[model samples]
Target: MQTFVTEAVDWPDTAPALRERVRALVAEHGERDQVRRANSWTKPDPQFSRKLGKAGLLGMTWPKEYGGHERSQLERYVAIEELLAAGAPVGAHWIADRQSGPLLLRLGNEELKRRWVPAIARGEAFACIGLSEPGSGSDLASVRTAARRDGDGWVLDGQKVWTTGAHVSHFMIALVRTEAGSERQKGLSQLVVPMDTPGVTVKPIVDLTGAHEFNEVFFDQVRLPGSALLGTEGEGWKQATAELSLERSGPERYLSSMVLFLELVRHASVHRNPELDMLVGRLAAEAWTLRLMSASVAAKLARGEDPALEATMVKDLGNSYEQAIPQLVQAAVDFGSPDNEVLRAVCFYLLQVSPSFSLRGGTREIVKGIIARGLGLR
Candidate 1:
């Protein structure tokens, strides 16, 4: 049976410097509202994203020829964690910088690279992953969206639902069936569909907070060049799973409720109680543990290793930790008091959104099943 491998991660020596730079940038331009900062990573501010691009913080690990800074993976990790901790508005470029750009650099054709990579690195372009569908949530293999060859090009016809950042994205890297009559995981392919394509449509799905972060995207006979295909056709399952390892393990997974945690700390400082004290301690410890686990996965990625199981594990635990913070704080603190207004506001916001923490990367059931299979329990 396999087990999670934990080891001391040797983060880069440049980490401290990178953290300082990110903190300074965020202080000057980050979101200021406590409620807005609760899940800051999902807060879109195109101007702030542009500022990060100008600061050489985006695309830190890719080739300089592709407009990247050519920095180490851990350095990139440091920058992102600092951004999340400070409640920086990074959602505009989050998907692009986090996974899409890296996937494109790894798998895209020359034309695809030339057309999107540099723009993405500059934060002028944003991307969204087209994975979930109407009947398919985390079951990627159940995707029915299809692409067919048409005289040296491809025609895409399908719809993707619950796509985060779709409305703000310039393009989408979608998983679709390439070969006719393919089933499950076979014959799947990733296609780069420009959001501005003639037949593409994006409709916003507003959440309970009246936020338009999720979207439904429709591709009605969208046409693309052969070069739009990402990675090997019929091997999209493998490529996409690899991309998901990048998605599942990151600071963003655990830091979504960090602003609330900070508010909890502030409330504890003024209103000292044993219950609040214990809650804060427990949350802090879990946050630290999740940070270590996440950093370990990042280190493995830097070394060209696929720690899919470990990444899945980190995401599961991190999601649970983040999702619990608001609930715990609401129970421990007195929201009826006027002094706890900031804390009350942040907690309520997170309570509404924390349900999505486990759903986004992969649902709790799906993530746990992956873990069980990895351990030979399934």
Candidate 2:
């Protein structure tokens, strides 16, 4: 069996300062409602996002020419860690800053880069990924979305489902079949489709919580210039997998239920019980360990290493840890008591949404399969 390796992360010297900066910004303008703060990364606050952009907190690791701060990767990591820990409303620019902007910087043509990267850095533009379809679920290889080449551009036609922030996004980086009769993952390409295109439409998908976070987007003969192609044609699967590595290992993966955890801590402090104390200790230890593992993966990425397997492991473990917190808290606390109202509210909210912890980024089954393949157990 291949063992999962753990290493000490040498955090950047600027981390403390960055953390302080992020904390102060979040304190001043972050979401105040406790329930809303539970999964704050999915909460859209465009004004708050623009504030982050103005603070130079958005696009921290890209080049200056593209309106990025050109900071170290770990420095960006520190900022995001602070934001997620504090339950800041960062959803508006989160996708763009996290993976879409990075993907563009890595492989986008000059026109695409110059057009989108700067707006992204300015928080004037936001992006959503078009990876899931109605029947495709996590099987991205089964995507039926297609784009056909025209005289000097392409014509897009298809629908994307479960697209987070699609209604608020300026564009979508979609994986579509570019070659006729392409099979599975072959002949796929990533296209930059502006959300405001003439033939594009977005319909909201309200969850049980009555939140409009996901959307169904349709492209009906949407026309795009040749420059809309993000990277090399027929290489989208490779490019997309690389992007998933970025998505799966971030602080957001584990910090979704942090507000509930904090509420539990608050309740325990006043209502003091051995069971609650033990639970707090266990959850804290797991949080610390996951943080270490996540930072280690970030460190490896900083060193120019591909830690896809390790990142996948982090996502899987972190999802489980996050999804368990609410259930554990519910079991340990007396939610019927009036004094526990705050804790009960946060816990119930998380319980309703925590199931999605393993579904987003990738499903638990898919993540485990990837880990199994990496360990040669499949």
Which of the numbered candidates is closest to the native, going by highest TM-score? 2
Give candidate 2's whole-model lDDT: 0.92
Off by over 4 Å in 1: none
Show where candidate 2 strays beyond 4 Å.
none
Per-residue lDDT of candidate 2, residues 1-378 (tens digit): 445677878899988888889999999999899998988889889999999999999999999999999999999999998999998999999999999999999999999899899999988899999999987888889988999999999999999999999999999999999998989999999999989999999999999988899999999999999999989999988898888988889989889998889999999999998999999999999999999989989988988988999999999999999999999998899877899888899899999999999999999999999988898885
Model 1, 87: alpha-carbon shift in Å? Answer: 0.8
What shift in Å separates residue 198 of candidate 1 from its native position after superposition?
0.3
Error of 1 at 201 (Å): 0.7
The alpha-carbon lDDT assigned to residue 309 of candidate 2 equals 94
Local distance difference test scores for all models: 0.91, 0.92
Give the Å error, residue 97, model 1.
Answer: 0.7
Query: Where does candidate 1 clash, by residue pair?
Result: none
TM-scores, each model vs. reference: 0.98, 0.99
How many pairs in model 1 have backbone atoms within 3 A of each other, for residues 3 or more apart or on separate chains, i.e. clashes? 0
